[model samples]
Target chain A: MQGFALYPFDPPGDIAALRAELRAWLAVNQPQGDIVARANCWASFDADFSRALGAAGYVGMTLPTRYGGGDRHPLERYVVIEELLAAGAPVGAHWIADRQTGPLILRYGSEEQRQRYLPGIAKGELFACIGLSEPGAGSDLAAVRTTARETAEGWRINGQKIWTTGAHFSHIMLALVRTEDGSERNAGLSQLLIDLDTPGITIRPIIDMAGHHDFNEVFFDDVLVPHGALVGTRGQGWQQVTAELGLERSGPERYLSSHALLAALIDAAGADPDPAVAALIGELTAELWTLRQLSMSTAAKLAAGEDPMVEASVVKELGNAFEQDMPRRVQAIVTSGWDDADDLARLLRALLIASPSFSLRGGTREVIRGIIARGLGLR
Target chain B: MSAAREMLCDTARAVFAEAATVGMAPIDNAGFGLLLVPEEQGGFGGDWGDVNAVLQISGVLVPGLPVAALIANASLQPAAAVSLMAGAMGHSLALSIEHVNTRQQFGRPLGKFQAVQQSLAVMACEVRAVEAAAAVLAARLDAVGLDPLAADFEIAAAKLRANRAVGVVTSVAHQVHGAIGFTREYDLSRVTIPLMRWRGEHGNDAYWAQILGRQVAGFGGRGLWEALTAR
Candidate 1:
């Protein structure tokens, strides 16, 4: 919190041209879907579109060329993802694998794991889900009761992971499980790269309030994975997961997930809007600009190999509030019918229902604020 | 920050410390008015980055002074005020953190309480956001050679964002300090009062909002994204 400096978001090798190329590609290739799908496009799954994006060398931009990746700079990857999100691309199919699992594996996974998973992930063919929250551990991630026992044959796992996003569609699960016999809390936990196709694995859909099957309840009934499934150190899952979250919490996705609504609102307002509408647009723009600065700086810090956990949390906290507030504020100012068919009305309706989950997902608002408080040395 | 800016900040801190007591005489004598003037013309050849850093210090040490007026022209005041507000809000957050960490309540430091922690976290986010806004605004100004019209979007956005942060930073800073922060003798008032004043000084919330909103509207929906990325 001291000497807050804006880390320069200087991506290498012709960023403007890169943006133009991506925009041109998206113009020709991005799927024409339901207008509402554009609001939270990350959650809009389209396997073909993802494959096309990967073919265009957009996915897995940061991984090494040895693993079938482009070997681009992390900031370059940041630019591509932000552009994808802002354009409302249906990136849901391979989002998790591309965002964290690919990088995490390249950083910590074994050679065999990288050889097996990295190529598929880079090709947008292998999807992944995080196995963190359970029925007993929502915000208290350390209260995980999931267990995986090492044996002469393999690691035997038996657990239930609730609220697991993309589990139904994912090819793998990066699971955090208790490994030590009597360990409690965050100790002795390990991350395992479990293939979701294993026997005794079940992924049941859990429909969200928006009527979208974005998350699921995954059950592991004596599922056995090879000993090679272990990622990083044996007992360092908490630290690894904490580092992974720094990647998760800060990104353009935090703010631009609902960018379509703002775009639609602006378009609907026309050139000379009413004073109230104009003022609302102005405030939202200011917030969006400030958030871009914060998010990019956090991304820059992370790219420089610095741990930006607190700054990441600050971006998450503020980005969540902005995205969450956009709809309610629009509702307050605009006089649109609930069941209207116009694009603005439809977007407003969709975002009003979707905004609550903005703060709740990734991390709850309270949890994020607590992290910031700790960063401020208040706790 | 560059080494040159660090040195500039050091000079600013020393001059502002003196100017805090006597008037703007020390700031004038130190030649801060010539900060943005070209070095070939016998001036510092400073950029907006220099002004931003110097004003932040001016905000923390001498918020009552007209340092921004001396350094920048009338048009750039909004941007200048944003840096000042960022500095003042950061100081308020720092002071509040110190007070809560030291002040005991319920047989424990106030900072230990989740309620106080949450409030301060919110305040900290506002402070950090303003700091980021001011920094980016400075970069944009420097990139465009300090032309106000060229950097209009950044100016309005940064000023509006800083203005909006004023209420939250000042309120939460005082809330965490209890009645002690309300006193004239306490240092909290120095920053909080000026933060409140600066919010309304250079394009308040509504002022910048309408201006930015209309500009964004002119960009249309898709054009807004193009403009933002292009800049």
Candidate 2:
């Protein structure tokens, strides 16, 4: 409907059918009010709304049913994520849980861990966060200085994690720490499932530029954990963490962050879009389609059980560039002040405020270029 | 265009895997370059996609194979390269260099001095131009069937850029490599050797300028750029 776009291939889902189903679901299950609006959607610390997602079985649709999932295709999960993001749904709370940690657990968790955790995760009864980044060690994950020493009971984790989104309100954090006594730096890293509510663990919110507590600094001070807390085999955490990063970095979420903003901006432009505005839309739309196909190709590859880290990096890097570029272009097209707050306008305000972190969040642009260079044979 | 491109890329990927050989040889050897022409065109069906893929895959063997005459022809497709494609070895790619070889005001290897940085930048510009143009054109080729002559212009531009500048980049590479380069055993020539050969084999900027000029004239002043860039 936007333009004569060459989507090129049949969209994976029957787009209309699924969109109609979701619209009906939303109409029946709208959130309580403006406070539970898109700004903080699922992440408004809204217990009731999260429970609603659980009841609707909207969480973790791709994992096995034994773990409270629909066991559907990854593309189905993609459809859900894209729809939520596009509608400006408050997915911030369970976003990390559903996106990265839940899948990592499913693939690498101990049987007991899977049975104890994933079902609640799929039900939205539980939330998860990641602790891969540290104050001194940001993009260089292997440089994580978190140290975990074995105690009489389990391992005691003693380190701090920065950029731990949703940690102040999260239930658990799957953290990577140096585990082995004297091994290769990468070899010593291992993932531990730490309870956020446990004593000696502190989570203090870091107000980002938008003044939201969406991100936090979490400190682990001799935190007690049982041996069952380890997510996977010891000494293999680097490889496991690498695999998890691939999952985290890839996905439609990488590209759809600005879809809501684009929609609002385009709608605001009205029926008589001038040639300049239309051209911007055309170019942006074409690039976005390329990203969608590349993302879908990665999903297909994953569904076929291949690790698509390199391809996923390429998609995320290119997609994030497009995402970051959208707001600047939108600002130029609209005459209104950017800080205006009329529902969709508020979403654009939030997106403009949040756009900088998009490139820095999963990985920096420099790191991504390094990856592409390696894949392109330049490195 | 998309269908044509997909088929060509898929087939080229398959052919390279089928025909390529031991480390460092496929690039420098004539046996492989001969495949650039279509097997029917007295040459192999080696297209730009194959060259791009080869450039990408070339890194799977770090520092990559030497670019030699045939590898150059494989990508640029000059008549001499076409001749080589027809099983003639054609003219060797050896360059007649006239590097000052002496230190100047800086008392350093003239090649090592900052004065030559422009030359290095120019060479780099050439490589950069080719890579960017190739990617941009590839994205477009998926949409329409342009005349091969249209692609011929693009390839000529890229080859000119590559040939003109590669000498600078590769020559400095040898200067940096030092006596080891002169030893002839070091693979330093792995990069420079192909730069020299490809430059001469493609008929260089002089030959391409004339051809491109003639082609543009025949287009009645509507050159490839004008056609391609038209909204």
Top lDDT hit: 1
TM-score of chain B of each: 0.98, 0.50
Candidate 1's TM-score reads 0.99
Residues B1-231 of candidate 2 have per-residue lDDT tens digits of 356545544553454343345553433343446544567866656554444444433322222234334454434345222211111101011110123233333655544443343333223322333333344333333233333454664544444434444555565545534475576774445445544555576576556544543443333311221232231
DockQ score for candidate 2: 0.03
**Tens-place lDDT digits, model 2, residues A1-379:** 0001111223356755665576577667756466214532434455556667777877888789988887867767776666665565667677788887888899899989988888988888788888889987887777788889988899998989998878877899999898886665687888999888888998888998877777889988988899889888888899998888888777877787776565554555445555555445444443444456556666767666777666677667767877887877767766666666575567657667778987887888667655543432221
Q: Candidate 1 chain B: minimum summed lDDT over ten consecutive residues — where?
A: B195-204
Winning model by DockQ: 1
**What's the CA error at residue B114 for candidate 2, in Å?**
21
Per residue, candidate 1 scores C-alpha lDDT tens digits across B100-214 of: 9999989999999999999999989899999999999999999999999999999999999999999899899989999999999899999999998988997789999999999
Q: Report the Cα interface RMSD of each model, rounded to 1 decimal.
A: 0.7, 16.1
Q: Categorize the docking of model 1.
A: high
Tell me what TM-score chain A of model 2 achieves.
0.91
